[model samples]
Target: MENLNIDLLKKIVSTYSPAGNETRICQLIKKEVEPYADEIYTDALGNLIVRKKGTGKKVLLAGHMDQIALMVTYVDDKGFLRFTNIGGISPAVTYSQRVIFENGTIGVIGCEKIDSLKDLTLDKLFIDIGATSKEEAEERVSIGDVCVYYSEVIVDDRHMIAPALDDRIGCYIMIEILKTMKSSKNDIYFVFTVQEEVGTRGAKTAGYAIEPDVAISFDVTATGDTPKARPMAVQLGHGPAVKVKDNSILCHPKVKNLMIDNAKKHSIPYQLEVLEFGGTDSGAIHLTRSGVPSGVLSIPTRYIHSTCEMVSLSDVKQTINLSIKILEEEI
Candidate 1:
């Protein structure tokens, strides 16, 4: 954590910023970007938009700040907590995991009797806060409180494992670019969007308001390097990836090629991504305002959408470099 940017990245990954509850993480972004941004504001949808002004084509770079979590739905008589998942959380990954609410309330996740794995669902899941009875539980937590996966970021020399990297890595790279970007001719909007995990909601509004001529979303994509993983051309430690296609949008050829060329020109290691499922902010951004050409630079990630997501530090560094290269040049 010697790198100031890396240290900020670790904190962003560890912070709880579940969908619809991104205020805390958004504040962190605001403080970090204020020094370098020409203008900054939060939109009606809670997207944090920062501006670096210039006199060329507008560029939008979005990274969602939301993560999957659970909400307290019902308090059972025996002091157990019945909850509904906020975003796409796998039951397999939630079992026995510690989840924390905004007020620092911690609970251990557990599940009801399941005859088989197919019987598994959010309805069968519960959270235990060690309350003696329903009354005590109500005193501690009430319906409508959200809880995020509770885990500390673990860092090795080359990799980081933690929750919320799905898009915190995006936030990190955007902040680094803002901090260290060279003089640029194109106007840039850095948006830390909300509610992307639930849907690309924030990006849609921000995109229309900014109406960028071109956009590049910073997000993570799956890698197939793990044991028996799905076959993907991208892999962790291979460097950042330029998006070709994903479930949401096909990257614009002109933008994608420019990213590829920038990486090659600068000697930044990179890969091409073809994700069959899952979408990022670019999915919505490209469709805004008469179709802005869009692309994505993804940090190769493993165990995505799970509590213990993993990413390569080298890939992240390369992404920052490549983004600066692309943003500084006239487009």
Candidate 2:
């Protein structure tokens, strides 16, 4: 499958771009996408919009660039940095992991572990930077400094594992599709939006700005295939998951059918995704202006919002191919 540019994908995932602090990653994306896009610019809220113009129709494809992380809330007398969540995060999985601050200082997230399962909570977690006093810890990393689980992309057995795969993989898919398309039928807007982990806030503003006739969101959704979790309609390695419905928006049937039919015609592997909780940028885009025909193209993911999320390389490739085909179709 042409190797799918593993080096570029790894680089994007490894770069730290947590919610509200996406300047560096956005700059990297701007450098990579400038030659291929007809126009590219950043909105006031830091959403990077790359456009490819055509006369057929206006279509918006959005994938959030932000990943779930933590914000430092309090520093204790013992020099432990206490943090509250900046987005939806599982404190259980984040415990005892090395984290990098926005300023590049390093620390370890430590939570009080106990034999009883009920004792595990976010309130019990704190970061230790080896400082004996709060003054020392504050000097290294401030009270407002943001932190994300420090992990790098590792490719093994045709799968990529790392933090922030939930949407960074989506970002990679959008950029690759923008790079490889031979011809375009629609005026495509490829947006790498911000603050999705917090509340899909960036998308609401950006969607309003574009007011696209059609919209599609590329992001990762949790797989039910994992052990003892909530039942989900997606599974890892199955293929790209087309959204039927999620917590926020019910996908437009015509758009969903178009995606499914395109996948079938091209013989691309795909599955239906019914997310029991959470949402994608499609949620915000669907309600834009008078309303737009919108749906989602999702990659099945495991350990979402944790330090080590996983996705199949094959699934991501399929997502890119399918998106390109859909954009090229006469609609």
Candidate 3:
């Protein structure tokens, strides 16, 4: 198996490309994939589409670039920023965390006095940027400005823990695949999508435009390996999970079987994933024009949506190997 590019993964995950604000991350990805792509362009919705032309089939691979964030709604008189959730943010996991705005303004999340932990909510939270008053806060941040969880990527001998790994790790996988894939007969479209954290918006648009014969999405899935966690079959360090079903879409049998067969043929480690909740870009891509067949490859992730989501290095490598096998062969 090929080695996982830890540096590349760290670089991509570190960028603050929250939903509706993907230009910076898109540019970074566009640069990384340009050399390997036959043609590259950005769609109206800011989805970075890189094509490797072929005549066998039009295959679309989507991995969203956007991460969950907080959008400022009001600035209090005392210079604290009140915000609303941009995606599926848990107040329990968000409190006392730090956030960084696009312009480099850093702030700490604070909450009002509450009687109990159950009473904690986003409404009670505020961001302190060290501003003395509303006017001062407005100078650095404005209504509608978004901020992402501020955290650093931590790499161990066998695992990676970082912020925004939900889909950024997916983006990193796609980028690596584009760079290392030797050749293919399918006209492949590698899309670094935006706003997936919100509603799979970018994939929906990109799918319509490409209208590929087959589609696959890369994203993270929750695990049951942690202490007394949900009873999920997936675990880190085992392998990639081939999607069977999720809340948003059912995996097409052909695509799902194709992944399983490829993994078996190549002796690649893999697991079956049936997420009881949550979804991926495949949810939107499969619903495209004429209803394209689609499936997903999920990395077993622990503590998803938290500041330090974790994935195994071995699992990442196996995912890349299986993905390459799927793309290099017939659809």
State each model's CA lDDT, in order. Answer: 0.91, 0.89, 0.93
Report the Cα RMSD per candidate: 1.4, 1.3, 0.8
Q: List the residue pairs that clash in candidate 1.
A: none
Give stretches of model 1 more than 4 Å off. 1-4
Q: Which has the better TM-score: candidate 1, or candidate 2?
A: 1
For model 1, what is the alpha-carbon lDDT of residue 39?
A: 97
Model 3 ranges with Cα > 4 A deviation: none
Q: List the residue pairs that clash in candidate 3.
A: none
Best by lDDT: 3
Q: TM-score: which candidate is best?
A: 3
Give the clashing residue pairs of candidate 2, or none. Answer: none
Tens-digit per-residue lDDT, 1-331, candidate 3: 5677788888899998899999889988888888898999999999999999998999999999999999999998999999999889999999999999999999999999999998999999999999999999999999999999999899988999999998988898898888888888999999999999899999999999999999999999999888999899999998999999999999999999999999999999999998999999999999988999999999999989989999998988888889999889967
- The digit string of per-residue lDDT tens for model 2 on 164-229 reads 887999999999998888897788999999999988988999999999888999999989987787
Q: Is candidate 2 or candidate 3 better by TM-score?
A: 3
Better of 2 and 3 by lDDT: 3
